[model samples]
Each structure stands twice: as structure tokens, then as C-alpha cells.
Target: MSKYWNEEIECMSREDMKKLQSERLVTQVKHVYENVPYYKKLMDEKGVTPDDINGIEDLHKLPFLTKADLREAYPYGLLAKPLSDCVRIQSTSGTTGKRVVAFYTQNDIDIWENCCARAIVAAGGTKDDVCQVCYGYGLFTGGPGLNGGSHKVGCLTLPMSSGNTERQIQFMMDLKSTILCCTPSYAAYIGESLKEMGYKPEDNKLKAGIFGAEPWTEEMRREIEKSLGIKAYDIYGLTETSGPGVSFECEEQTGMHINEDHFIAEIIDPKTGEVLPEGSKGELVFTSITKEAFPLLRYRTRDICVLTREKCSCGRTLVKMSKPMGRSDDMMIIRGVNVFPSQIETVLIEQGYSPNYLIEVDRVNNTDTLDISVEMNAEQFSDTIKDIQKKEAELVAAIKTMLGINPKVHLVSPKSIARSEGKAVRVIDKRKLH
Candidate 1:
């Protein structure tokens, strides 16, 4: 059971990794400039030619691609390879105007699976393990990405898509699943379900879990680990960048390691678009160097995090990225204060409330209001009105201390809030600022 899937690439020196990225980036840029007219137009407007981008140092000269750009480009605008060359397409679960669709050739899928294999192996997966993939299949990238990776690792793979909790548990107990892959929220729900079924955390055979696809706090990770009796690892990715194996946590559990051979990562000031120095907290940007069907150059991920080349005990030389703090586009601005749902979640978990909570923001009479509905755990749920009000006030004060703004807190009964099988919807903003 080796700790790494590919030791040569994962442990490549910084100098050699940069050289590989430069070569791939140059060839990828030329391919996109020659084939993708929409990206070519953006590069032309920015006065950047393929020759202008010689290596990673010149990456800042390229135009940034945002979600809006993807929407504007629509179905075929950003396709670098021809339709015949593309073998599959995975879409973002965004419910907004246009869903982001990413295309992949067979080679692209192979590379993506290899990236995911690195994630699994880093999590202590082996050929003898049973990898249960509960992420949604078909269009969603989570299931397919981990599924292919499990196959590549020669694990006995179970393609159990999201939802159907009872069946999931039955399969887990029967087949003795060793590795579980899904979003963090869903993992929590599964842990709760197993406990309710009179099965202790030690009863299940699951040893490690890979959770991602939503923003979660460290508190939630500890809670899940306790409930499931497994070491929880975080995997980070987006559909545009070839899904959940872009980077992953190793045994060190410090931060996720980015696969620099396939993609180059950069952090930039969100407002000014200036690339930030290393260890600076800023928006994350990714450039797909090896992607064939859809090689996005300087794609603005909008995720707020910092990257560090700090050496890891896991022995991989890949750069480690802090778990995303929040999204620049999703951060709520109320009464001129920036609030992220993760901040509220931290308070909830610390206050002995369930991680499942809803933040509703609305504007009334030219004033913004913040209201939070938190789920009280079975032990915390109370029957008396005064007791509930007292708990709510305590949460209000705690959240005020954390966010610098008071919010009306309502504690609901246990399991009152809807649980999501996919990315959990934590915030609902009714203000029409657009």
C-alpha cells in the first residue's frame, strides 16, 4: 500500500514541475488560440498572443475567464477541441442562467481519473479496499470522477449515486465499504442515519472518507469524523477544471495538494486582478494545461483561499491550498458588513447546534435584515418557550461576536431543516441588487 499513486510526478521538484507546466501551458495556449475563437477574441482584446505567454511567469498577461464568460460562451463557444474529439461532458449544478458545461476527451478523462487516483491513494486507499461513490452520477462530476479513480486504483467500486439512504447503508454494511466519497453535508446525514439505526461508529467498516463540493468548516469535519469513525479528507475541484481531483488532502491533513503537472494555480486580488504573492489570501485562479477538449487558461475560480509551497510530511512536493474560505460572489453583504455562511456555521457547531442551518437575507424599507434558522440537536431541543428563546439569544450574542452584526436566531426541532444529497443550499438572499 504505497502512500502515493504516482511518486514521480507527485514528488517532482519545484523546478521540474514548473518546467513541465511551462511546456504544457505553451502547447495548450497555442491549441486554444488556434481552435477556440471565443478565447482567442478575449486574448486578442487583451493584446496577448500565444507567443506572449511563454511560461507560468507570463500567466498574468492572459485574460481571465469567469462564470459570466462561460455563460456568454454557452454550449460551443469555449470548446477547444472539435465535437468529435470530445467524448463526455459534465455540467455544474448551478440553477442560475446557464449551467457551466465542461467537455472532455478520452485522454482528458484518463488524466482526470489519474488525478483522482492520487487523491484516493493519499487517503490510504488500496486495491483491496471497497470505494463507495455516493456522489451523483451522469452529469455531475463528483460520482464519475471518484468512480473512475476507484477503478484505476483497482478498488472494488460501488457506483451508488447520491440519495437512497437506507440502500446506501445496507450496501455499506453488507459489502464493508472502506472509502466513502460525497459532499460533507451528505456525509453528516449518513452518520446520523447510521447512529439512528442503532449502529455505532465502530460498527461500520468505513475507514476513510473524501468529502467536498461545498464549503464546510473544520468543526463539521471533526463532527463527521467522530460520528463515522473515519479519517475525513477534503477534495477540491470544479467541473471546468476536471472535477474533484484537482487537489486533495493527504495523511498530514494540513491542506490539499494541487496536481501541478495537470494544472497551474495562482492567487490574485479579486478587485484589481493583480496576481498576489505566495501565502497571500486572495481569489484562486486555475489554468488547465493538459485538458484537451476544454483547456481553460487563467480561469477565475472566485474561491477565496491561500496557497503555500510548504513542505508536507506526506512527502508530496505539490503545492498545498488552504480550504476555500468562501466565494467572493457568494459572500453576503448586510449593513455594509461581509458575512460568509461558513462563519455562521462555525458559531452553530461551536454552540452545540446541528450544522444544518439556513441564512435568509432580505431588504425592508431600505434596510438589510439577517435571519438564521438553526436546527437544534436532539439533546438541545427544548419544549419550553423561555428555554428556546434563551438559547436563541445566546446564539445571537455568539454570532454577533463572530460577525460583528446581530441576527435574529430561530432554533428549530431536530431534523426540521431539509437535508441535501448534493451541495447544500445554506443561504437565501431576497434582495434584488442586480
Candidate 2:
């Protein structure tokens, strides 16, 4: 079996995958009932037993778990094993003081590592390739999860743990790292750094990138690939789902192939709570059937996506989901059309402006209008202020062409926008909704 974005498991027959999911679901239900008291109580409160969750198709009968539920349980509330049994624990960044934590038994960690190895292999990675992971470690799951996975794949792994771009580049050059892992924005920063250091893309060691933890557009992907000389692939996951590696991109590069044997994915309308069929746009839900330390049932991911069971060019039988266009929580009802800030980023990048931009929404008279502030690159500074004004007009015109809405464009100096090392706050809404 070739190690690439599409795995041998992806090509499994539909009947086989469903049967496997059914067996795993039953096993996971029993595992949770016997280990975690919190889940047992939840199941009991609903007058349901582990046997009630017999098959993957019956998932809707069970209670849905949310991030808020995980927060309430905190560190040990939902753990399926005793503290000693769990070899590792990871927490959300907790930027707002309330963090969702997850635990991993030694066996759980091994499964996670294998999934990551499969992801690497799917993206054309081999044991000889050096893996440089730039995700943060400690309570955050990105670093350690991928770190373990890289090693499992027999690659020399670099746990860079985000930031320190210069040092990251230095180590990359020294080690000749072929696989890069980090947020897409950070990858963009690294690409800019390479250019500033007078390095040629062909001479650099990077081959492919596994990017996630932020919402990005296909336009951004083309920009990254063009600048870095690497095919940037999307990885979908969270701490609740055992970090990244839940799904991965294959050589087809169309969409991410979900790991059906481990996690059952579903799409549903957040308002009506009805399951959306494949090809329908809605929020993504995941039920972890193989996770041991913290198995989540019907966990609402809040990511907006479309699921498709269509066969891919790759030989994998795994289901594919579109790249998350935005989060349900992050969707803004502007005027009439739904607007995601990444939409603006896509437009700005396409217009040859800096990707660093912001959206300020406020009420004008009675209607809401959005003011988009974009940073001008150094290349545009040599011109007069009048030229800058004309440039802003051109940007506004371009955004309209792309998003089908007109927004006020404000020109700012280079480096005016906040540098986002973590989650980027793109919108500031001041309008009052009735």
C-alpha cells in the first residue's frame, strides 16, 4: 500500500464501511458506559442504555454533545479512564478562560498516531521525509498529536511548536524537512520569510503542507502553493476529536476523506436539528467510535460544510467533505446575504493586496454597512496618496465582483492589521439586531 492522501481504507465498499461503523459504535457505547460516569449518567437520564446505541444509523436517538458540555465537565469529568490510565491530556487554548479538555490513554494515543501516519502517507510522505510540525504543544493538541504521528510513520519529526519563524526556517534548512504542518496563515508567513531571506522555492526543503485550525479559502491555497512550492492540504479536527487527523486530503486534492472506520460524520441543520443528506450544506457532526479516553457522541463541530459520498479519483472508499467555508457561529447575516470574513480575505488576496485585512460592521441610518480595511503592500507605497485612493476604489470594485456585495474599502499602511499567530479576529460588529 502506498502512503498517500488516499488510503486503502478509502476504497472500501459502502456496505463494508457501514457494517464496520455499526460494530464499532456498539463497542464504543459499551466502553463509555463501563468507564466514564458522566456519559453513563447522560445515557441513564435519557432512559437509554449502551444497547440503545446499536448501529451508526441510530445516532440521532442519542443526546448530542457540544463544546459547552465538554467545558462544564472540564478536565476529568468526561474521561473514560482513570488518571493513571490516561497517558496524555490536552486542553483548548481557553482564550476566554473556559477550556474543553480531553484525555488519551496509551492505547488511544497509539490510534491517534496511526491516524496521523496514515494522513502523512496519503500526502505522499515516506519515512525518509523530514516532518516539521509548527503547531503548539502542551495543553494544545496540535503539536504532540502530529509529533507522535510523524514518528510512527518512521520520519524524522521536528516539533517546532509554532512561531520562531527564523529558527523554524533554520531547522528546516538544516534537516531538509519535506513535510510542513501548521496553520495556513503561519505557512504564508513562512513563505514571505523565505522570500525576504532570498531563498528560491526550488531550493527550499518543503514539499507538502498539512494546514488547519483556521478557515481559509481555495484562493488562499493557490497563493500558498505558488509561494512555497508545495501542495497545501487541509486537515480537519479539534481537541474534542483527538486533534488533527480526523480526515485528510489525498492526491486528488478535491476534498478531505473522512476516516469512516473510526469516526462517523453527519451533517445537520443547526436550527431544525434534522440530518442533511449528502451534498446538502450544513453544520458537521462527528461521533467518535474508536476513541477511548474521551469518546464523544454526535459532537457538534460547528463547521459549515457539504458531505459527498461520491467516489474520488483516488482508490479510497472514505467519504469526502468540502473544506469548511466558515463556522456556523462565525456566519454573519449582512444586509441579506450571509458573509464570512474569509470571503473578504479571498477577495483581497486575489486582487494582489496583503491578506491582512479587517471588517468593521455598523449601522448607517437604519441599514447595516461593512467597512473593510486592508493593508497595502510596500510595492504600492511609492505612488501618491491619489494613487492609493484609486487603489482602494479598485479593491472595493474587486470585492463586489467576488462577493456580490459592495463594501467600503479603507487603505492602511503596511503592518497596520494585527498579526494573528493564533485565531484571527476578522470582524467587529457594532450594529444592533432586532
Which candidate leads the pack in TM-score? 1
Top-scoring candidate (lDDT): 1
Q: Alpha-carbon error at 339 in model 1, in Å?
A: 1.5
lDDT of 1 by residue, 155-217 (tens): 999999999999999999999999999999999999999999999999999999999988889
Candidate 2 is scored at a TM of: 0.91
Candidate 2 residues lying further than 4 Å off, grouped into runs, are 4-8, 41-47, 333-337, 361-369, 381-386, 400-406, 425-434
Expressed as tens digits, the lDDT of each residue in 1-434 for candidate 2 is: 46453344667789989999999999988988898788888889988887777788777877778888888888777888778888888887665448888889888888887778778888778888899999887788778878888998888999889888899999989889999988888888788788889987877878999888778888888888878899998887778888888888888888888888889999999888799888999989999999988899888998889888887887777888899888755677778878888888888887888777889989889887989988877887656878888888898888887678889999888778876655567788888675
TM-score of each: 0.98, 0.91
